[model samples]
Target chain A: MNLIEKYAAEVGKYLPSRNRADIEAEIRSTLEDMLEERAQAPNADREALTLQLLKEYGAPRKVAESYGAVQYLIGPRLYPIFEMVLKIVAAVLLGVGLLGFGVNAVRMDMAGPALVHALGKLFVDSFGGVMMAFGNIVLVFAVLERVLPLSDQKDLTDEWEPADLAKEQDPDRVKTSDLIAEIVFTVIFLALFNLYSQYVGIVIFNDNQWTFIPVLTEAFFRYMPWINLLWTLQIGLHVWLLRKGMWDVPTRLINLAFKLGSIGLAYAMLIGPAIIKVNTESLAGTSLAEVARELSPLSQFILVPFLIAMIIAPVVEIVQTVIYLVRRRSSVPFPVK
Target chain B: MENDELIQNMVFELRRGIISIAVLSLLGKEEYGYSLLKALSDQGLEVDQSTLYPLLRRLESQGLLQSDWRIVDEARPRRYYVISPQGREVLAQLKKEWASMTESMQKLLS
Candidate 1:
């Protein structure tokens, strides 16, 4: 093989399997073209010249970066947002997983093997699913970044003017107070999680002996740490939005929708069959289960409030996001602040 | 008045608001790595790559900047930076403060 062909094969090792051949062919052609140019030069040694060009062109890693996927926890373009989301998600997922493991271990000690196996499978499935989903998503985004051309490349048309670029920004950009608010909100979430944990301890676990109250309460408490982590990320998103000085109105609405969805889930947990047994046990023979079961399916009396809180609240939040986006856009400079 | 002392104070005061504003404003565009220093310097800020690069990283860790990389050519690549929304808002507010300070300075000098 020629000198150029040798270097091309070496660099091909780093590229994805699908693109490797094409990239190799491109590199091979380029190198051969370079070698032909040097063919007429006085002191050009083919082998040494090939190596010199490769060295200047960079190693396989650098060369591959040109055609490689965007770096992201879930994908290249989505990486930053994905990473921010992952830190929040992973912290919660792992914490919840740990709690699930603890609970299963506890149940194994106290109850039969059947329950233990069920809980174990659930924990494994949940944790494994989350991690796998994150990895797969990053892979997908990296692949997409390779395929997509979403970059801002307008500068190639016009050389950037040094003077205009260097002009100092008008003072009155960035507020420290916003950062402080984010910090304060995150601290509030942390504090609330601690207090809820303590409250669960007093009402359920502290009473000794496993009861329905403790079992269910522990489940909620186990998820509380995850809630705290979620809160931290939510605040982090706020901080990112503040710094970027631009808001995606739809994205904000989506966030509100998700928050409301979660609240809806909590409500479902409260009134659903799952809660009936716990409520009946905790509050004495009033048997909240029997009462809930007896209520008419068409009963809008209770449903109205629940619907208002869950469905209506999110709608209001979406409207608020739209209004906020419009207002901020008017006030803020573009290219993001 | 001492020329050196006056220049020193002027530099310090200019820096007082400028550094934070510049950092915040830069991050508002996109997340970046060490190139931030070069970009700043190329704009005539003359920030030390060592100091500015580390600070950019710190701000990112603090959740103010987001970054990613792109290849401009088949032979070379670079990481890009942008500012977060919160960083933008912060920049806006800081700009307000900076303008007011500049006005006050102008008044005093006049």
Candidate 2:
């Protein structure tokens, strides 16, 4: 390629893919035109003039950047939620790390340098695990940044109204944070249930290493397709709510429909085969062996309440939605200010 | 700041704010990037290629200008830009604002 061709290509590398060719062509044409003007002067050398033209045009990267392409991994519109998620994830990781450390420390019967060394090693290992978790979170957010539609990622071009804020009181307003949290959690559950279901069980430190016990049963896997369908629709709903920025009648009805689906799933899970299983046999010779033996049969007793609550909470929400669909209260729970 | 630096900075600020208005006004006729640059320079409104091209794209994206690439009196293909109907309306308003601003400044300075 010629010097101008090379220069344009370098600039094209930095432009967004959507408009890269057009921009590159424009830059090249402009440079050639400039060079043409300079060449009209007496004794002008074409190559020398081309070099001077490119120099005046500034560096290729700088020229490309002047177009103001979207530069964020997680842009300003999603930044607050990203920050909130990072904080929540960091705290949860720290709590789990400390809990793990305590369990390992309790398992240790040493009282001197051995205990310190083991504790030191455990701390280092936990720190590494936490760092890995943070990296995974960043990866997820980066993917989310690209995966979200341009309409959602970039600030909306629509005319905004201060009156809209006044109308969106506490109950009616869509909290971006709440929708984002819902999306994040639903995505996590989907990933966990589908990709990392084997690691869903209780992990016990045994025989000088960590042993992962798969807690979910085959019955749960049978229901996987249904669960995936519901969760996918649920994520779609959340994205719609995020873009709409408030709940109206139709969205509430849609949400009510999803909640009813949830009730169906919960009812089926309650009546059907077990979803979670604790194999005390797998926990033998570990720190949780005795506890597992005691609690394995009582796992249903622990799980039944949550399933019942899941059914009950959605029922109540459904009732409320029907009531609101009948008549929405005008009273705000508190002052707007 | 040095006097030269102060002058350059102040001139840059003045130029940056009005470049949009000037470009909008000048693009009443369809012109490609280089022709547009020369047109502006001929009228003594100095602007960088970096500034002008991006501004053109931005204004187009904002629905104020329309552009398309076609060969126009040149062997090379060039992206020609013209003021849109929306741009004409905006430019009229901007022109009024500019006139009022300059008039007020003239009064204050006098």
Interface RMSD of each: 12.8, 0.6
TM-score of each: 0.31, 0.80
Candidate 1 residue spans exceeding 4 A from truth: A1-3, A9-77, A99-127, A139-309, A318-337, B1-110
Q: What is the lDDT, from 0 to 100, of the residue A152 in candidate 1?
A: 26
| TM-score, cand. 1 vs. native | 0.31
Candidate 1: give the TM-score of chain A: 0.36
Error of 2 at A11 (Å): 1.9
* Each candidate's fnat: 0.00, 0.94
Please, what are the lDDT tens digits per residue for candidate 2 over residues A1-337?
A: 9999999999988889999998898888888888877799788899888888888889888888898854777777678888888798788766765665566557555567765666566566557655755666667677667766655432366655556666745677777677777788787678778877875755445455555567788898999999999999999998788766678777887898899999999999999999998877765886778856754676688689999998999999899778865555344454322
Q: What would the per-residue lDDT of candidate 1 be over residues A12-70, giving only the tens digit for each residue?
A: 77666765775576556445544556666887687787778667666766666555422
Angstrom error at residue A265, model 1? 12
Across residues B5-100, which tens digit of lDDT does each residue of candidate 2 receive?
A: 999999999999999999999988999898898899999998888889989989999999999879855588888899999999999999999999
Candidate 1 CAPRI-style tier: incorrect
